[model samples]
Target chain A: MSTSEGTTSSVKVGGLTLEVHRRGAGKPLLLLAGEEQLELDAPFVAELARTHEVIIPSAPGFGHSERPDWITSPDDIAYMYLDLIDVLELRDVVVVGFALGGWIAAELATKTDRSISKLVLVDSYGVKLGSPTDRDILDIWTSRPEKVLAAKWADPAMGKRDFSKMNDDELTIIARNIESFARFCWEPYMHNPKLKQRLHRIKAPTLLIWGEKDGVISTSYGEGFAKLIPGARFAVVPGAAHYPQIEAPEAFLSTLRGFIG
Target chain B: MDAWHFTEMPYPNLPPIDSLSTMRVSLPNKLFDPKIGADLYNRYLDEYMIADDLGLNLLCNEHHQTATCIDVAAPLTAAILARQTSKGRICILGNPIANRGDPLRIAEEMAMIDCISHGRLDVGFVRGVPYEIFAANTNPTTTVERLWEGIDLVVKAWAPCDEPFNFEGRFTQRRAINLWPRPYQTPHPGIWITGSSDLENIKRAAGRGFVFATFLQPHEKVKWMFEGYRSAYRDTGLPGGGGTAYMPLVYTAETEEEAEKGAKELTWYLNAKAEPQYRNPPGYVPVDFNVNALKGTFTGRTDAMRAKTMEFLKEEGVMVYGTPDSVAKQIKRLYDLVGGFDHLLMMQQAGWLDHARTVKSMSLFAKEVYPQIRDLPRTKPLESRAAAE
Candidate 1:
């Protein structure tokens, strides 16, 4: 259970062995990950863990998590997290999610606000904000590698990985994460068709954050997403792209602190 | 030794390769001049007609949003060949059933084509290539499962069911499943399934008594696959002999000089480039395959294949091209190496090999090479052969 950052543990939830990364000790703050796994020792995570009981779990089928055959969509993951909350006995938890994780967080909130006290979605993906013909998000699967990299971070180099040098375990995790991402997002192209209509159902206090330079999904799209959730405030982190928490950690945390505190 | 003539029907005239990042998926369609494409389609169909006249079976394949194959839909071409050609058995290798919307529709279309050809139809179902995951807008993670389910549904639909049965599967649902026009062939025309590296699918295809095919891999790998299929076929104890097929670039000429030139031109099919990211879409291939790819034990086509010389290709048994007698010898060598394969899917035309050269190659292959190797004995059981050895 002990790790370099804090501790790693597995919690049996909804027939899946959920891999949870825990740091700090205070009020529960459930952190959901996005395209890439969170850097457990990142300054932003370290800072947040100082003020909150930071708990991060890899979405089912991502990282070391066991994905049962029945867990096929983000909605299923959301339901599993709901089970995680009851099993861990966490209450008044502040739920924060990034990118794909943000989509799951929003889905979880819409279903029930019983365990959630507040919600923060950072550069999230889960809603259709455009006309049927319009593309609201960049398709990383089909887009040129350079285009996808450039759109993913303010500095494209931040998104680049020397996969050839990566070890087998590292490569396996990356492959599994991508496969899981595709499982949830490929058909709907990164958004749940019904999530747009259900955003109103989220009863918790909400904040939507966008990186000002995020090319994957524009700030206007973020603003439109915020408008869907009643009382949700939209904040923009300057000098960042799709992954503001990685590219502009301090700015992202400050905005998150202002709203959550 | 039934030979099937095939081409990707490529529109090779394009701007320099350096100007484009990829040849597929996101390639701009505006660059495709419809006038030239019109001429190319007619020429390609004309090549198929020539193959038909020469007593070669015709095979058509489909790819989407790529200049490499302008034949966007194989059924359209298969339907055309079914009507236009008299004797040649028509095969579409085949409908991307997993990517397609309705399995019933595919069943209907294949059945219609079978009726038109009067049972000279070999229906092929494919999971499509990794790059096609983008073009088809289908989920890659569940494609293999979807493909198998789709095949099962199609087979059941083609079965002699008097009552309309309901089909309820994970990917597809139907209230009533009664095929209007049953296939012309009894118990349906021959079912063919193709896979490159998936041995499980090869075994499954064999177990079901479907003709299994692997295209353009190194012969050693094909030999391994053939061994796997033979073993699995034995395990299943399927009735009648199982059918196995192989596709290799094939061109034959009257002289060595022309044969070498045609062989080089035909490799244009191998050189069609897609960006590395597009080439390995997540979930399109199994995680083990991707993990192995990252470790550099790549099972898919390697970059070496693109840079391979005609000599190297011939040596690898990926391509069989030479004078008529030489071509026969190369195929016989391949036959021995892979134990044996019943159907030879010949990619006789590709790249800048002009229509004249394609026709010439087909004619030469049919007239000379075909007769020389047409009756190679049916492959004896590998175990029996090993015991004999």
Candidate 2:
């Protein structure tokens, strides 16, 4: 429904096969896959795949890549791709970022409108949930017992993940990333104070998505993002959590599809 | 603009021309890529004014829920077309209101567009599709009765009455209130009747001087649609005689190869498309009822309609497709077949056709074919037609 200028794409971007599925014929939409490990089931990313040439990079440390300790903040992860896009020579690219990846997209989008075209940030928690009373303890992903997990997720089934079974070293790395993420963002928590003012500088169109039922970040944060960015839209998806990319995938992706100019 | 046919009903005499717009709405599922629907409406005042400027006629039809045909259920889309295409002849063959609670809305919308378009309006009323009737939870059994009642109410609303529109039909209740913003045309833009009806409907249309048209099907099925009007015209002795109209799905191209290429898959698409409609009489979704029997009835003797159209490279091609020349030859047959062609509005947007495709068809037709038929002498103003006749 949204056309990325040239009306027709002369050369189709992206390869025919990727572990994840992508569909339709138009601009290349880059997906960070997840805040967690990206294994192709990032629903919103998959939904975007329906009409776009979706690019999902399995963030090095999380899925197949060896877990590294020094790379704490998301800015470290978004750093390489400024040149990768040049190597691939992709143009008019739209980035759909969620959770941790949302943090990277936010950080990356503020710096470059060069290779990047548009940015879509979902129910993300790059900041410390931004509200004290609205404190989402789930942002750090510590080993909270069932009752506290249920309280945080609101969905009772989400109360049960085998966090206790993880090795201490793996747990340590996870905790470090959390601490580094909060450091880059906790002052504003979910947003960069400089980024909010700088949003007007980014030439590309920006679209933000949040869950109406988001147990992680208040929908007000989504509104905050919309107001901060020039020509930005924040749509709240129903029955979702901090992870709208997973919960209400269709609605989340559709809002993304409609927003990317 | 004055020479442009203001109403699209069954007209017989038209010069040979290739490529014309024909209106056909694909069911909406294949119509979209998602569970949620897509909106096909573009501009209102702009489209009509553009068509008026470019010499193209405007059209829209009825539909209910199905991902394919959004909200023809309310006729808002058609009204939008009316407002948008104000410069062109506004055609709304709608409001399957026989199944509706009250048809006053139909009268109101028609009158509004008529006035807005300055009487550049053609009003088409129909006996609701039987499946659509059942889908609306109305009585398909009394389709004709409901249709007759609808016409009576709309006419009374338009023509005015010494007494109020005081009448009680099986599905209505109306005692008074003539509509406002009365249409600009004195007698109201040409009245049209569309659907599969016997002589009675045709005779009535002839007596009232209403224009007659049908959808999808070919001539044989409703040849009586023509004969009945002619019969009534001869019997009642209207000076110029009655005329007929058809709004089949039409498409044309730069050359026969292009047309053949385009229409080759179109008929296959039509048959494939017609199945679901025929199979589902009134399913969980309204348009999904896919009423095949009635769908067939709307078309011609299916096989004959198919083959007969092919022979008439003269106007009988199975479908409207070909380079400018082949199309002109085929359209000529249709002009002659119905005896006169006062109007021909196309239905181009089909399932899976993007806006780019729609623009291409309109562009080609506007460039090549429309020129051939720009001087439609059979389509003179009423006073001129009367003098010629």
Candidate 3:
């Protein structure tokens, strides 16, 4: 079960087997990776593991996880995570999600009353907050890699990696992750139409973290998402794009620690 | 072999290819001029009518958000053609059922077209090209399964069974699956499936006794696909060569030099209109298929073909264009190369091939080429042929 950086284990959630990476010691913090490339051993996740018991599970059809044929949408994954929580008998769980995972976290929070103690959404995607002509979320699926990277990162240079150096296995995993993400988020387009109305059903204390320079989804979207959830706090991590934790790890962790503490 | 005239119904008047990376999926709508679109639609319809007059089957295809193809709705065009043409079989090659939210709607539309055409309707189903999955916002992972389920639902809906049936598919579900007006043709219209080197699709097409079409691939790849289809049909205990069809980009004129001059538009279509990234978004084709492509085992198409010269394409038999006699000879070579085919869907119009030239090519192909190759021996059941031998 032990990997190079962390110990990985498989947990049966309903009919599917999900791979979870466990590290750190204190209170259980369920870390949900984003739609793009489910990297369990990312530096940000590693940094968070130093303080809390970080349980990062690769969503179905992502990385080494087993995706059941019926698991098509984000709601399915949300329910699966809820089942994962029940199966693990985990209590007072602080659920943190990034991008697509953030949308899933919001869904998971609405479904449960006590299992999740707190919710942290990092540059989340779920709310539609603009005119019909306005593009709320960047169409990353069809865009060029450099354009997507430019939108996703505070500095595109940070995200640029020589893909040619990667072997076939690495490329295959990347492809699978992208495919799985598309499977979950392509239709209804990274947001649920009913999610805005259902935000009132969430029982946990919520924190909306926005990367100030996020080009994928604007800060206004993050603010709107916060406004919908009752008793939710909105915080901005400056000098970062869609993935603040990746671009500005120190600022992101400090903000997270302040909210979780 | 039966001849069918096909076009992507391209909006040829557009900005340079250097200005845009692709013609599909992400192509800006600002580039589309409604006046031009209005002219093109009617002009394309006129071309279809001309093909019908010349005694050729009419073929139309659908693509979403693309200048490469203005036929956004195949059934709509088929419905129009049904009302317009009398004798020619209107073939929609075809509606991308996987992208559609409801398969029953397709069943209803096709049935309506059949009723309008007075039973001369050929239903051609396709998994669609890669970019279409993105354009329609459908999941590629489940496209093949969804396509099968959709076809099954459509077929069941069109069946003559009086009792209402229910369909609970993995991708779609419905209660009381019954279609009104049924279809003009009993047992529904003839089903055809277009594929390019996807063996699973070929098998599905052959197993269901649906016509198998290989479009826009090299001749060697088409030959391999035809062999696969024949083998699959034999395995299913079906007779004949799986009702195989091939659609190649074609242009013909009075002289070889004139034909070659006209064929430049096709070169533009091949090089610029067929952008690789737009044609193949991630997860559109299966990972295994791509891997096989990389290993040189799968010979359908590669990105490198985009850079191919017109002469190279002609040499490769990806295109057939010349004087009437020369074109006829080349088609015969193609027919022999692929063993035999039931139909030949010739794309006489592509890129910016003007209406006049398109008409000329269509007229020439109908008059000269069709007569020569129409009676070529079609592929028969491999098992039976082996027994006779």
TM-score each candidate.
Answer: 0.96, 0.47, 0.92
Estimate, for each residue in B1-389, the C-alpha lDDT of model 3 and write its tens digit.
88999888898788878887777777789999999999999999999999999999999999888888899999999999999989899998987998886899999999999999999999988888777877777777788888888998898899887788888878787898778879999878999998875787887688788899877677888888887778778778763224989877799899999999888787655654544445555567776654444444443353556767777777666888999999899888888877788888988888889899999999999999899988988776466535322
DockQ ranking, high to low: 1, 3, 2
- Most lDDT-accurate candidate: 1
Off by over 4 Å in 2: A1-261, B1-39, B43-50, B71-74, B161-165, B219-224, B239-242, B272-318, B374-389
lDDT of 1 by residue, B1-389 (tens): 89999999998998887788778877888899989999999999988988999999999999999989999989999999998899999988988999996999999999999998888999999999888888888888988989999999998999898689998888999987889899998888888889877888988988888888889888998998888788777777674346889999998998889899898898888888888777878788888787887677774584658877778889989999999999999999999898898999999988899988889999999999999888987654456435322
lDDT measured at residue A155 in model 1 versus the true structure, 0 to 100: 96
lDDT of 1 by residue, A213-247 (tens): 99999999999999999999999999999988888
Per-residue error at B264 for model 3, in Å? 1.8
Full ranking by lDDT: 1, 3, 2
Docking class of 2: incorrect
User: What is the TM-score of candidate 1?
Assistant: 0.96
lDDT of 2 by residue, B61-104 (tens): 55543323444533465466666564566666656766665778
Question: Using DockQ as the measure, which candidate wins?
Answer: 1
Query: Candidate 1 chain A: minimum summed lDDT over ten consecutive residues — where?
Result: A35-44
